[model samples]
Target: MTATDNSTVRDADALRADMVRALHDQDAITSEPVAAAFAVVPRHRFAPEAPLDLAYDLHSTVPVKKDENGLNLSVMSAAHLQAVMLEQADIKPGMKVLEIGSGGYNAALIQELVGNDGVVTTVDIDRDVVDRARRCLDDAGYGQVKTVLADAEAGVPDDAPYDRIIVTAAAWDIPPSWIKELTGNGRLVVPLTVRGTTRSIAFDRDGEGLISRSYRLARFVPMQGEGAAKERKALLRDGVVVQTDDERVPLNTKALNQALDTPRREFWSGAAYDLPDELELYLTLHLSSAARLHASKEIVDSGFVETSALLGVPALVSEDSIAYRTRRENEDTGGFESGVVAHGPQAEALADEYLKLLRRWAENHRCRGAATIRFLPGPAPSTLPENSVLKRHGIVAVSWH
Candidate 1:
């Protein structure tokens, strides 16, 4: 059957159950409230145009809105990642919640979890998204929730003292105003970029100080409108494509595009793992740091293919890994190194560290277990590294200036 035809048969309840199962598999649906919220919200309604195969995928991203350039501007987010955010927030009923990016799907889910006693106010910079979200909510019988088409950076101050605030986009830094608007004991969950890695973190305001509990590696479309981020420089290397725009950071698919043509056999044929894969892996890990250290990747073709061949590339890290494609031109040898391009030392370092961490994390945890990665703002330590463990509850702490 066609995608829309399939959507007709699979109702929201069934889809929600499947989503719950997916979250459970990822260890994200730990709370009964979060599970019920996922069960009650109809995700398909929010992303009607998604492919049929993706309708039931637990960790797939469903595009909700795309920009003029065909870039996804907003999305429903991956099911597992959403669950991770909820779990991290420790959402409860009767809590006033502020959602920076609003749509019927996410607001409805939050409203269901917060229950009738609680209040949910969603804000979006784009009036179109706001109006569309309103229509969707009304259609879904969620008229009680409030939606505003204004800058999220200023925040919904009139309704200040929110018990919980969730920002569903990648933010360069948490606005001080958001913290001030939060309740004395409020929780502000945001996807924060540290160095170059984006991880969702739930920061709780305790008295005058703020503390974070959970962290999960995540990738989200950049937050736009009022507090939009400044553009970042693109990394340029031989045999790769780079694209940039005025508002957002430059696209960094040079390495990914290069991976498509590079034969996997270049790295894997002689060794147990693929060389191109290893190089790619190194790039991913180091990119996080490179984004922090040097806003760009500068690779000099060092012909270190043999060194890369020795180290087996670690398996993919997260669900988003599926979104990437590594292809080959000829069938004779695995096209591990044809399409892929190595940007710079940072990319290579990221790939190398990713391999090491994958092995270490797997050995220690056995299962990823819906683990969260969080970055917390902390004062640089006198003796320890800037991000040293200021406080550790159940998540890792990476300090951001």
Candidate 2:
């Protein structure tokens, strides 16, 4: 090989080693098989358009395809997240795996985990993504992995009864086909969006339904096509918005905007605030009229909304009022204390309800992984279970213990 070719190879190898070490240090790579896979995969080959540094970045995603509006339609998911999900899947050699989203690198990594005896098929809704993934896989010497061009909402039944089904995109619900196509003891690791937040939940078949083994906070491009999210969004102003999928949550945009004009009310919960993911799950599920409150940095900087809204926070909404969580540093509480910010005539009542839930969570479920999530795949029950969110395919029931 020429000197320039040798240098490029060395650089890629060095970056791969660094990436594996960082993933291991962060506890994302817990098993030897996963670490080895990360060590060997030439991640940069999958996203040839991206720089080598970006391809190896532990926490950054490499964009592959974009839509007409410049929104990402497909991306090579971040390495740390890939490692975390792989650990969650716990793939064994000779297992048949079907990945719901097409990204060549992740599917290649799965091929490494499953070894030569296993089958790896990746499906995507976008034809461009499937074509790109196929080219990248062939270029990266992973041509053994099958690529399918179709919406993964129904999953790839051509290879049924997969031992593991890993979804790379954010899913709104667990469709019936996914469960039926899985082996009796199969595992489905999906980034499931509940309320407005997404969690990478590792679920195992429990009778006809599925139950979570663990869940981690996750962010991903929303799934497109048949399984797209049905959430409604109201742009209250240039920098603020409210979104919800719950039919009962009143989306009175005019009244909600008027509430923002009224004086804001603050209520302190006197409860220690930490473990944001766990706290958020509790708030979103328990709030009667739950919605997500989001604000741009400009609005937050102008003092119209708390920084919490910058990344979307659980909100209790009424026809003409809203209350959401905020935080402040408190030495007595060990770090921060949770509080509620309210607006409109029912601010006091909304704040009271929000504060009660916050305190209850802090007192009873302050730690991580305290909630158990179950996906009951069937018609909605006449009386929905407490702390449950309804979906087109089924109901997501979550309980904190």
Candidate 3:
């Protein structure tokens, strides 16, 4: 090989080593097998067009394809996120694995974990993504990894049962096909979005339903095809918006905007504010009429809504009112105290209901992995459990334990 090629090879090796160490330090790589896979795989080879630094960046994603509106269709997920999900899967050598979203790099990592005796299949709805993944996998010396063009809703059943099914996209629901395709003791690691919030949950089969082993904060491009999320969004104004997946929640944009014009009311919970992600899950699940409130930085800077709305905080809404989470510096509450901000005619009621949840979450489920999520397939039971969110295929219920 030429000296230029030799230099590029050396650079990649050094970068890969750095990435492995960083993943370990970041606690993304916990297992020796996962570390070995990260070390051996040529991550840059999967994103050849990308700069070496970007390909090796611990927390940055390399864009692959984009829609006409400049929105991402697919991206090579961040190394840190991938490592975290893989560790959740905990695949063993000679195990059958299937990756729902086709990204050559992740599939290649799965291939390394499964080894030569195992098989890896990656399926994607976009033909371009599938073809690109196929080419990249071949170039990265993972030719055995199969790439297929199809919607992920109906999994690659030809492979029968996969010991581990890892979904890279943000799935709205756990389709029956996915559970049917998993082995008896199989685990599926998916970025499951509910109530407009996404979490990468590692679930294992329990009877006909699936139960969560652990969940971590995650963000990904929404899944496409039949399993695509039925997103409900209302633009309150140029810079403010409300989004929800639950059809039960009303998004009266005009009334809500009018309510914003009313004076804002503040309600303090007098509870400690820690572990925001966990608190978000509890609030979203327990809130009777839950939606997500979002505000652009420009609008936030204009002093319209609190900073919590900037990150799309859980909101409780009525026909003419809205209330969302907020925080304050409180030495008594041990640094920060959770609170609620409300607007419109029913502000007091909305704020009261929301405040109750904020205090409940802070008092009880304030720690990590405090929720047990169960995906029960088929039609909902006549008597649904508390904190259950209805889905097309099944019911996703969460309980704080």
Candidate 4:
């Protein structure tokens, strides 16, 4: 290993301890095996370009790349977020796990967790990333984890019947091949996007259907290769990409599409920090059946929403999202707070009728300080990374219990 690689390994050891503490603080991880696995796996090794300080920032989202237009391509998810996924997955030794995105550092953690009994097969569309991961894993003596240079959308069918499947990259929908390849009761944890919002959804197969038990707002690089397209290959309306999905519902269609020009003057409408009574009731009835449950973030002026002192909620999104801010401040803010100007689909009057359900979810279920959202697998198996909506463009409510 080079000098930089050696330093990263050392930093990971320290970062692992901090990560454990952060997990405990959030009440996100409870498994000892999983925690130990994360501790041993060197994250910096996989992401060579990331800064040293970021290697251990518990709540940081490591940026992978950005285009000239300022669009982010990929990110290394926060430690707590990944920990939640691993805990939900209940990954065990002797089980075969199919992982998307060949990040050497993350794969190393999986390899350590699976031990010799378990096998990890990672696929990535970028040949360069795949090759880099291969070298990192091999150098770290984790060559046992098989690395494949292929489009993740295709799903590694040759290694079918996997006990667990995890996609590091965010997908629009769960590819049908992945569902087909899963063993009965198998788990599939994918970062899903629905109606322009992205979330990490974890589901388990139950007979003919799949049930989502957990979800989180997450962002990652879009998938590429056989199951993905190279360019937009479409027209844009006012710089926004348009969808061609069949529209059946007409409720507030115009209002949903209409853009607001003037800002509303409402101070802490109880919409940002607290859920309204109406929304609380909705979530109670449909929390279980909620489908395509994804979350998005919006930053508004503090004048509209009341905030605490100078230490306002720097990032004003809900629980199911990654912070859109600098890493240094995100750790201190810990995301949303009591006082801050926040905006979301749930907060909009056009969507508020159904979004209020999210509030009830917080009251009924103990979110471990965060809310639980679910995304169901879509009808089309071919569209692995496309949003799968049940009703409108947004997440639809589904029944769980």
Compared with the true structure, what per-residue lDDT tens digits does model 3 show for residues 186-274? 99999999888899999999999899999999999889999888878989999899999878899998999999999999999999888
Best of the candidates, lDDT: 2
Per-residue CA lDDT of candidate 4, range 304-365, in tens? 22222122112212222111111112334354312112233333432333333333343454
Candidate 1, 1-401: lDDT as tens digits: 99966767565556667678878877988988888888777677666677545855787787778999999887777778778888888878898999988766788888998899999999988777888889888877899999998888778887888999999988766666787888888898998654344668787775554666665667888888655655454333352223222222224455444543343321111111233322332333333232211211222134323232222221222111101112244455553322222323233433444445334322343332233234344453455343222221111243322
Candidate 2 TM-score over all chains jointly: 0.98
Superposed by TM-score, candidate 4 places the C-alpha of residue 40 at a distance from the truth, in angstroms, of 1.2
Q: What TM-score goes with each of the models?
A: 0.64, 0.98, 0.98, 0.66
Order the candidates by TM-score, highest first.
2, 3, 4, 1
Distance from true location, Cα of 173 in model 4, Å: 1.3
Rank by lDDT, highest first: 2, 3, 1, 4
For model 1, where is the 10-residue window of minimal lDDT?
316-325
Indicate whether candidate 1 or candidate 4 has the larger TM-score: 4
lDDT of 2 at 198: 98
Q: State the lDDT at 119 in candidate 2.
A: 99
- lDDT score of residue 245 within candidate 1: 21
Stretches of candidate 4 above 4 Å error?
A: 1-12, 68-70, 225-259, 262-299, 302-388, 391-397
